[model samples]
Target: MGVHGHAVGVDFGTSTSLVAARAGRLPVEVVPLGRTTRSFPSIAGFRGEQLLVGEDTDDLSGDAVIRSAKRAITQNLETLSVAGRRIPADEVITALLAEIGRRAEAVDQPLSMARDLRLGCPAMWDGAQRQRLLGLAEKAGFPIDETTLVDEPIAAGIAWVMNRSLFYGERLEGRLLVFDMGGGTLDIAVLDVLSDGPGTEPEISVLSALGAELAGDKLDQAIAGDLTSDLAAQGHSSSSARRPELFTALVLRAARDAKIALSQRAEHRIMLPSRQLGQLPMLTYTREKLEEAFRPQMDIAEALVWAALRASRLTVRDNRSAADLRVLTPEALRGDVDYVLLAGGMSRIPYVERRLGALFPGAQVFDNAGVQPDEAIVAGLADTISYRRLNLHRPGFDFIIEWEEGGQLRQEILYPAHTPFYSPQQVLSGQSDLGFARHDRDFPGPRSGSGRLRVRSTSGEYLGLAVDNQTMDGLVVRFGNRMDFKLYCDGRILIRDGSGRALHMRVDRWPVIRGRDSGRLQLRSAVDREPIVPTGWYMDKEYAPPIR
Candidate 1:
């Protein structure tokens, strides 16, 4: 299997990246990037003209290595400095993607011939970030397009639902809350799943998604800071302080390892190398200490969950404003949620599960059995490619365009939720006269020469395109000027005036259907006769014990 005709799914994570592939109806396989492990570090190192990535960067010095390059996309940073060289953030990301491609091809020769490649990203990434990643993937030689991106939590949900149906013979429906806390971010999504008659695929709709940049890495820093303070109190010489950056890096790595170890045991020994920390004594980091360090971030994470639930519009016994809403004790949601699926590496912590279990007392909460939390996203991403091949995917949100007219809000539905993004008749095209003269007798527009337009989802979340007169007067002009509006399958909206001037805005979100559903067209009779047992790494893993 050269992956010549396979569907590849990539989870371009904050700390590590994973690649999975499915060929025809074959089981999805996680492509190994390291000698023994599947994970590839999301870091890059520069030495003169030579570039190193992932595990290869492990030996590089702090000044020469770029870690968490993914954060650059979120911060909108244009360049990163490495080894006294300034490099474009896009180039660094592209290099990482390119390396992944190379490794996948190494495992399966000519993986470059893969028919499709899909990437998983955070749900909260705006349009610009998504587009930037898409561009970088293309630069890396992946056959990616606008529809290649899938929200991480959505991917995790898909994996959980598919795993349940295929292995346990259980059909999960109703509302689901996906709590994904990875190395760099915490993303929470509330989705509604509806099943039709037996054997028919369930309809999945994302009610709301929210995220914050608070996760594993932040906790690691807190632990490191605590260790540094402890060392200072012991009268350890500050000689290592001269190379503060190097010393901090070593401590942080030790802290991260200790955190992971604490997940499995009550305590972990964190021993920094003498070369890195001088003659410091071995440190024993306890789970209690880790919990204390994580408390503040955990508090923020709990509040974020509440915010996401409220935004989902799910039924609650008492709906209160943010000011009055109880942060952690969201008893109102206990009866509303049917299941809580934990995902991301950070979710493996016992404390996280306990917290979620306590919050959703009436609901079943658990991680996908046999599936590693970090790999869930990639598995779901690969399964999505398989679903699309069978025409069993649908859009998750309704696309809408809005404007102001006669002091009232005017809007039009460009694409309704669950519609196929590639449907010929559904694709937005052509020009429509705004009839500015009819609405405003004082034609030729305002002296400022601008107007406002917004593109958003039915959930009331804006999708990044908000053109106001202050920015562009010629496009949203008055005086009955005709304009063309075209929405591409990739979430790109292009507007053109009669004068041929054009304005482009990307929807800042992916159009791929998140949950599960048949395409706009009816499913094939064969699909209805036999349920598709999605094959993936999850199939062989033992189920996790249920959390009641």
Candidate 2:
């Protein structure tokens, strides 16, 4: 697919946010949202009645800035009044995204001209959470859709292939593990390179996917905890019991800066400007000390990586997909896996890279020059749009699609559990016959509608964006098999089964939502009893609706 025009991609991260775009024939370009930075801090606060985001936010004794809102949103922090109105990560994230959109529009070349927008998200977000993210993007001003909500690791994987596949395409005969460690989450995906044809490219089959709440922010907290204890040991007059908020706010920023510095330098000194201790001396932190503090977090990260691989039923040798299997070590393979692509801000840390390399020593690791950890997801998303359209989404479940083939009724699949969907242009040669469904342009009616608002409930039958009142794309929703409800995606309305080889097409269902933490859009079934509900908002579901 020859990318002909402009398309925007946004990576709304835990610590920061990025907006990128790909113009015709150009590389993915990061849209600078700050005066001197391409990455924008994902924090928002209120100054009186006005909302402020990014560079303008200040720590007004912890009341002014909302930090780690993404985690709160994902975990469904019920005491959202925990962070005030932006509580649970809703309003603050939307505000942050709106700010990003403003920045993109200000660029001289006019990125505003881009018609479609793609947003990257954690792979672990389930149906409700994904629905919530789409809702937030609408509140933030980006017109997104169900299909546009792509997995972050998959986007990073595409970006990896874009850079390395030109020469290494054929050599990537085996699978490549995508290990993404960002500010707030760790995501891993095992992709099997489709090499069944003579001229196959980097099209991949996502074997298994998994994510963890652990990430760089946790490392920063670990470091801060260590520093706080050491400072208290030095007989500094500290009472977190008295002012816990202030203490953490002060320590977290200082600790994060120290970590970033320690990445490029051997040592860093942190100043604890405190009144309790009456101006303490500077604390010197070496990379070794930082790594030591990160030990526990790294251990969890390593475990999650191997766990994800194990989920794929992949090991050093072939075996029955039936019998149990074990994860292989670098020594076990000796040399089989081709590459291990690392993305996210934490990957810049030498200790992280070292640990990852030790786990997969047989493969080459690329960090994309360390210039754009926050930008990779969005950049790759843009590349997917402008370069070749491919959706690396893993199907949620196996659907029994009933279609007619040789004048006889048959049952097959719209998509398999581990297979990926690709545009006709992006499909590799032999892989082309796989017959994966696409959601591009098959609808004949209105493309979208005023979104069906999901208020307090177990959850919707199927969580997908609505295209008009009649048609919708069916999201393979996760729910108990016995329950019943409607499923929708873009333009396709779904019942319990379908023809195996279906093509997806619907451009009008671009997702747009009027989200608000307080808006009550209650939906119930024609049947009795509600089955699904939000455990919590994922990606900060609803803090405030757009000012539409």
lDDT of each: 0.65, 0.58
Per-model TM values vs. the true structure: 0.71, 0.68
Q: List where candidate 1 sits over 4 angstroms from the true fold.
A: 1-6, 23-26, 81-86, 109-111, 237-240, 314-329, 384-548
How well does candidate 2 match the true structure, expressed as C-alpha RMSD? 13.9
- Span of ten consecutive residues with least summed lDDT in model 1: 427-436
- Candidate 1 displacement at residue 246 in angstroms: 0.8
Q: List model 1 lDDT by residue over 1-548, tens digit each.
A: 11225677899988899898766544568889876788888889877778888888777776678878888886789998766678888888998989888988888823467666678888767655776887888788887654577788888887776666544557667888999999888988777676553344556666656677889889999998888887778775345465666676677778889889999999998777777556778888899999999989888888777766654542121333232432324676466689999999999898899888888888888787337888888887877332432211233444443455678765555445433222111111211111001112222233323354433433345443223213321225322344444443223345443333445543323334322231221111111222333233333346521111
Q: What's the count of clashing pairs in each model shown?
A: 4, 25
Say which candidate scores most in lDDT.
1
